[model samples]
Structures are given as C-alpha cells and as structure tokens.
Target: MTKPIYIHGSGCVSVQPTFEAGYFFDHVTSYTQNPVPALDPDYKAFIPALQLRRMNKSMRMAIFASRMAMQQAGITTVDAIITGSGLGCLRDSERFVEALRTDEGSLLNPTPFIQSTHNMAAAALALSLGCKGYNMTYVNNANSFESALLDAMIYLTEHPAATILLGGVDELGERTTQFWDLANYLKRDDATIPTPLIEQATPGEIATEGATFFVASQEPGDHTFGKIRAVETRLEVDAPEIFISGFLQRNGIEAETLDAVVLGYNGDSRYDEIYRTLGSSLFANLPQIAFKHVVGEYDTVVAAALFLALGIFQRQHVPQRLLLNHSSIPPILRRILIYTQRRGQNHSVILVEK
Candidate 1:
C-alpha cells in the first residue's frame, strides 16, 4: 500500500509575482507574448553575492524557492533533496555551445560548461542546504515533476520519518526561444494574455519558465497544507476518459467527490481538447480550473499546479480568475485532482486532499 505523504509548505518563482509578498494568482503578472521570463526576485536573501555571481537563473530560482519552502515548513534541513527540470540551465548550455561552436572548442570559459548539466540544480540545492543524503534529479520531458514526486513518495513511505525537499525548475534562454519560435512552438505575437481556453486559439503555447518547491513528509504536522494521495504519469496519452477513470478508481476517489479539478489548459487548440474531453464529461459540474494561462507553460509547469492546489488547501480560497467554468465556490474544498499533459504526451494525474 502507498503511504500517505503530506505537503507542509511550498514556494514558487514564476512569471507572476510568486516569490513576492502576496498570493501569486491574486496580483498576477500579465504578459502579451510567448516565451515570457520569470519576474526577478531578490535572491540576495537566500544566496550570497559571491556564490550568486556564478549561479545561473535556474539555480537561483531553485535555491530561493527551496529556502522559502523550508522556512514555511518550520524545518531547518531536509533528509534529502530532489529536483526535476526538462531543459536545465538553458542559458548556460546555450552559452557553452555558442563558445564551442564559435571558437571550435578552443579556450572556452569553464563557467557555462560547468553549470550546463541537468543535475547541477539539485547539486546546487544540496550544497546550499548542506544536505548530503540521497540527492537526485529527474529529467523526463514534461513528466519531470511527477517523476520526482513519485520518488519522494517511495522514499518517505520506506523511511517514514524523513523529510524531502522536492522541486521543479526551468529557465528561458535567447537561443532556446529562438529555436522554438522558428519551430512555431510559441504562440504568435498577436496572441494575448489570459489565453482563450476552449475557444479558438492558434497552435502553440506560451513559452514561460519558473520553479515550484515543496516540503513533503510522511506524517502530517501543524503546518500541513494538503496530503498527496496519489501521483501517476504516462509517456503517451491513449484513452482520455479511461485513463482518468482508472486513476481515480485506483486511488479510491470518485469523480463526483472531487471539490475541484485543476486542468492544464495552455490555450493550444491542437491539444487543449485533451482536457476539454474530460472537463465536459467527468467534471462538467465540478469547479474546473485552468492555470497555464496564469503561470504560463513549461515542461514542469504541472509543479505550479501542485503549488496552486497547496495554496487552495492553505487558504481554502480559489480566486475567481482560475475558474474556467464559473460557479459559486464550494462551501469547503476537501479534495482536488490535478491533471496535465505536455503537447498531448507525458500525461500526469495527481490527487490531493485537504
């Protein structure tokens, strides 16, 4: 049997002012174009100038978010650290490749080369927190966050008393965006903010980046925000309704009992229908919410959805903006289901109970 895992605290750094003083969805940071970059936060508090100088944007976001989550959970340290990222440190990777291409691998600066790997983010977090046990990173396309989440669950179920600092982060890069733009993977310039979900939208998604960190543990405490009941990921999405039904049945949660279902509707007409199929049938009357329009979509953007669920469990409030289909808020939000897919692949479903 799967052991119960609860989230004590969470932190997010995203296109919105997530790392700021207020709830991110409340004072949203709007955008008009694709490939939006995360708002810069004051990193000096979590990182010293000397170390910050060498760290890339992705690393900074990870460290700051991890610190914020730890503080909120009222814990000084974690037994382990795990992170997930699709394109880890693209800025550094881009620079390193450019230098190698330009100079034919002659006298290239080692800074970018040293920081370009995918595991570097987890490495930086462990080094910063002085944690030396069971550190790992997962890079599984858009399933990255869910991959890390499942691993954390397995570890905690076995350890029973260990705490894990888990997170997902991705950064924007000039060259990377340019490549995406050429491939038409980004929404056109005319595409506006608050993406028109279920409405006519041109092909492509908003290329944005951010990080979400959580302090997950085996036992619930005073700081508990929500309990993660189950997490599942699929490399390919075959049957929409069947997949969701099976997932819910496995977790002993019925569709009618979910207070809310968070869907990743990123405004791509080609793929948004994947969510619509489920929203229209299984969750028609439920308080259906979509978030990519708020935070924008990245490989690990589902991590932001997890963060959103934690916020709702923490405050018992779901801001009106996130509601896709309007309805009076539930008297009490007890169960939430978060479902997301990356371009119709890497499908993930997570169950959270408050």
Candidate 2:
C-alpha cells in the first residue's frame, strides 16, 4: 500500500508579498510589461553576508524559502532535500554566456559555471542543512515540481520517520524572456490584460518566476496543512474529464467530495480553454480557484499554487481574487484537486486533503 504524506509547513517567494508574515495576496501586484521577475526578499534575514554575496537570485530565493519552511515545521534538519526547476539557474547561465561572449570563451568565472547546474539548488540546500540523505532535483519542463513531489512521496512511504524538504525554483532570465517574447509565449506589453485569467484573452500568458518550499512527512502533526492524497501526471490526455475520473477513481474519491480546485489558468487564451472546459463541466459544483494570473506562468509556478492551497486549508476561506466562479461554499475545506498544464502538455492532477 502507498503511504500518505502530509505537509507540515510551506514558504513562498513570488511577485506578491508572500514572504511577509500573514500576507496572502491581500494586495495584488501588477505589471506594465511581460515576463516579470519575482520581488526580492531581504536575503540577509536568511543567508549570512559571506554566503549571500555569492548566490544568484534563484539560489537565494530557494534557500530563504527553505529556511522559512523549516522554521515553520520546527525542524533542525531534513532527511532529504528535493527541488525542481525548468531553467535551473537562469541568471547564472546568462552570466556564463555573457562571460563567454565578452571573453571569447576564455578566462571563465568558475562561480557561475559551478552554480549553473540544474541540481545546484537541492545540493546547496543539502549542504547548508548538513543533510546527506537522498538529494535530488527534477529538471522536467512544466511538470518539474510534480516530479519532485512524486519522489518525496515515495521516499516518505518507505521511510516513515523521514521528513523531506521539497520545493521548486525558477527564475526569469534576460535571454529566456527575449526568446519567449519571440515565441509569443508572453503577453504583449502594449495590451492591457486582466489577470488570474482572462476569458477574453490574447495569445500569451503573464510570464513570471518564483520559488516555494514545503516540508512533508508520513505522519501528520498539529501544524500540518493537509495530506496529499494523490498526484498524477500525463503526457497527453484525449479527454480531460475521463482522465480526471480515472485519477480520482484510483484514489477512491468521488467528484462530489472535492471542496475546491486550484486550476492553473495563466491567462493564455491558447490553454485557458483547457481549464474552462473542465471547470464548467466535471467540476461544475466545485469552487474553482486560480493563481497564475497573479503569479504568472513558469515551469515551477505550481509550487506557489501548493503554498496557496495550504493557505486555503489553514484559512478555510477562498480569496476573492482567486475565485473564478461562484459555487456553494462547502461546510468545511477538506479536499482540493489541483490541475495544471503548460501549452496543453505535461498535464498534472494533484489531490490535497485536510
């Protein structure tokens, strides 16, 4: 039998003021341009000056978020550290490329080169916390974060006493922004687009970056946010409703049991329909919530969504900004089903329960 995993704590660093104490997107952040960068937190609070001086944006965010998660979980160390990212260390990669161009591929700075690897965040976290156990990082596309979640779940199942630090980190890059703009993956700066998602939307999404971490264990605690009932990912699904039914069936849950759904609608017209179709049909009676409009789209943005889900469970209320459609409020917030996709691929379904 597969063991259940429970989330004890979560931390998120995003475009909004998520790092602040008791902040929950109460005030939304806006952007005049596309592919916005995440707001910088006070790195000194988490990392010392000597170490902070050498870290890039993504590393700092990941480390700080991990620290916050550990603090909330009341843990000095974890048995493992698992992270996922699409572009890895984009800022470091850019620095490396720039150095190559300026120096004619000679006199390379080893700092950026060393930190540019995809597993650097996990490795760094492991080193910082002195955790030598199962450290891994998933570099899959949009499903990278979920891939990390899968590994954590399996690890927790076999090691019941183990607590794992799981997270996803992705940062905006100069070259990445430019390339995405060229590929029409970014909303036009000239156009005013309403966010979470726009029913009447243009071709692109609000591209942004962030880092979020959570502490997961096989046992629940007083501070636990909820239990992750199941996680499923599909490369391609012919019918979303049928696919979701199979997923819930595998987990022995009925559609009516879901209290809410955190849908990843990034305001990209090309893919918003994917959520719209499912929302109006299979999950018609369920409260539908979304975050990508506010957080924007990134391979790891769903990491932030997990944080939001924890907030929903803790608060037992849905933020007005995240509610896409009106549904009768459930007596209690118990189960939440999350669905995310990128360009209609790497589709993922995750279930969380209080």
Candidate 3:
C-alpha cells in the first residue's frame, strides 16, 4: 500500500489573492478576460530585485510559492525539489521562438532560451534553496501535478527522513494564448470569473496561469495541513465515475464516506457533463465544491485544487463561492476527493484527508 504523504504547509499564486495571509476562496477576484493572468504577489518580498527581473513568470511564481510553503512549515530548506509544468516558461519559449524567426537564425539572446526548458523551474528551486538532492520535473500535460505528487509520495516512502518541496507551475504565453483562441480552446464570450457553471455553462475554458507548492514528508507534524492518501490519473477514461470508483476501492473507501468532493466544473458545456453526471448520481448528497472558475484553467491548475483542499482542512468550512451543491456542510470536514479533467481527458483524482 502507498503511504500517506503529509503536507506540512502549502502556498498558492493564482487569479485570486491566494498569496494573502488569510485569503480563502470566499472573495474571489473576478476577471472579464478569457486568458486571465495570475495576481502578482510582491516578488520583491521573496526574490531579490535583480534576480527577480531576470526570472520568468514560472520561475518567479515557483520560487515564491515554494518559499511560502517552507515558511509555513518552519523550514529554511528542503532535501529535494520536484515540480511539474504542462508548459514551462512559456513566455520565454515564445520569446525565443520569435527571436529565432525574426533574427533569421543569427545569434540570439540566450536568457530566454536558457530559461525555456521544462525543468528550469525545478532547477531554479534547487539553486535558490541550495538543494542538491533529487530534483525532477514532470511535463505530462494536465497530469503534470499528479505525476509529480505520486513521485513525491514514492520518494518520501523510500526516504522517510527526507523533507521535500513538491509543486506545479505554469505561465501564459502571448502567442500560445492566441493559438488557443484560434483552436477554440478558450472562451471568448461571457468570459468572466465565478464562471457560470452547469446551467449557464459555456463551450470553452478560461485559460490562466499560477503555481502552488507544498512542503511534504513521510511523518505527520503538529502543524500539518493534511495528508494525501492517494492520487491517480488516467489519460483517457470512458467513464469518470467508474475510474473514480476504482481508485476509491483501491484505497478502501467509498463515496458515502467522503465529507466533501471537489469537482472541476470549469463552465465548459461540452465537458462539464462528466461532473454533472457524477453530481447527480454519486455526489448528490455531498458538499460539492469547485475552484477553476476563480483560478481559471491551466495544465497545472489542479495544484490549486490541492491547495484549496488543505485550506478546507484547516478552516473546516467550505466557502460559498466554491460550493456547487446544496448539500449541508459536514459538521467536521475531512477526507475530500478532488476529481478534475480537461476536455474529457487527463482525468485525475486525489484523495485528501485531515
């Protein structure tokens, strides 16, 4: 059996004021743009101005969020750093590509090129923390965060004495957003935060960017937010409910036992039905919650869901903005199951408990 990995602390940087001290999902920051950008925290507080200027959005957010997690965990450094990104340093990548085309293969600026790789965020964390231990970055599309999380669990099980920083970071690119617009992957009309879900669902996602990080170890701490019981991801699932059931069975739990559930209802009509069906059948009696509408959708946005789960564990309350069902809130919130998918693919389920 996989051991539960304890989350000592977590931090997030998203469309909402997730970096704020007491910020939960209660007062979400709404956006009218389709591809909303993440709210920029005072980077000067966490990063040196000179170094911060040289970093791209991914590196900046990753380092800042990881630092927040470490601070909350009361640690100066971690033994290892592992992260995931669906699209790494996208802005830098776009810059490099544009430079290549504009310069006609001539010598080009190397800063963007050097920072464009998928592993740069993890590398940046390692450098910033002086961590020379195991470092990895997963780039498996929307499953990136789950992949990194599963690896973190395995690493902790093998190295019980080690503490690690695990997280996911992704940034928006100008050209990339334009491409998504052309591909009809983004909502152009009625694109607003607190996205109208289910009844007022739209056809495309509201693309955005952000990062979330956690300090984790094999042993539980007094200040531990929660424990990740299990995480599973499937590239394609014919029936999401069945896939979720199988995962729950493997973990020896059932839907009825869960205190609350987090569903990825991003307001896309074509794919929201998967969640709607599950809500009507399996999760009808539970407090169903959501986050993507406020944070917007990104390959690694599910990391924000995990952050929200930890927050729920701490507060033992479900904010009204996130609540999607009429079910009464459980007196004691524990054991939250988070299920998310992008366009009916990369379906993932994470079982969390306080």
* Full-model lDDT, candidate 3: 0.93
Candidate 2 vs candidate 3: the TM-score winner is 3
Give a tens-digit lDDT track for model 1, residues 1-354.
667689998999998888876665865666787778898889999899999998999999999998999999999899999889999999999999999999998999998999999989899999998899999889999999999999989999888989999899999999988898898778886565677778766688988899999999999999999999999988986897888899999977789889999999989888999888888899888989889987888999999999999899778899778888875568889999999997888999999999
Top-lDDT candidate index: 3
Decide which is better by lDDT, 2 or 3.
3
Q: Higher lDDT: candidate 1 or 2?
A: 1
Off by over 4 Å in 1: none
- The candidate that wins on TM-score is 3
- TM agreement with the true structure for every prediction: 0.97, 0.97, 0.99
TM-score of 3: 0.99
RMSD of each: 1.1, 1.4, 0.7
Clashes of each: 0, 1, 0
Q: How would you encode candidate 2's per-residue C-alpha lDDT over 1-354 as one tens digit per residue?
A: 667799998889998889999998777877777767888888898889999888888889899999999899898889989899999998899889899999998889888989998888887788788999999999999999999999888888899999899999998888878898898877885433237355566688777788999999999998899888788898888898899999999988889989999998887788889889998899989999988878888999888988998898899988888888889778789889999999999999999888
The lDDT per prediction is 0.89, 0.87, 0.93
Q: Give the C-alpha miss distance for residue 324 in model 2, angstroms.
A: 0.5
Q: How does model 1 fare in lDDT?
A: 0.89
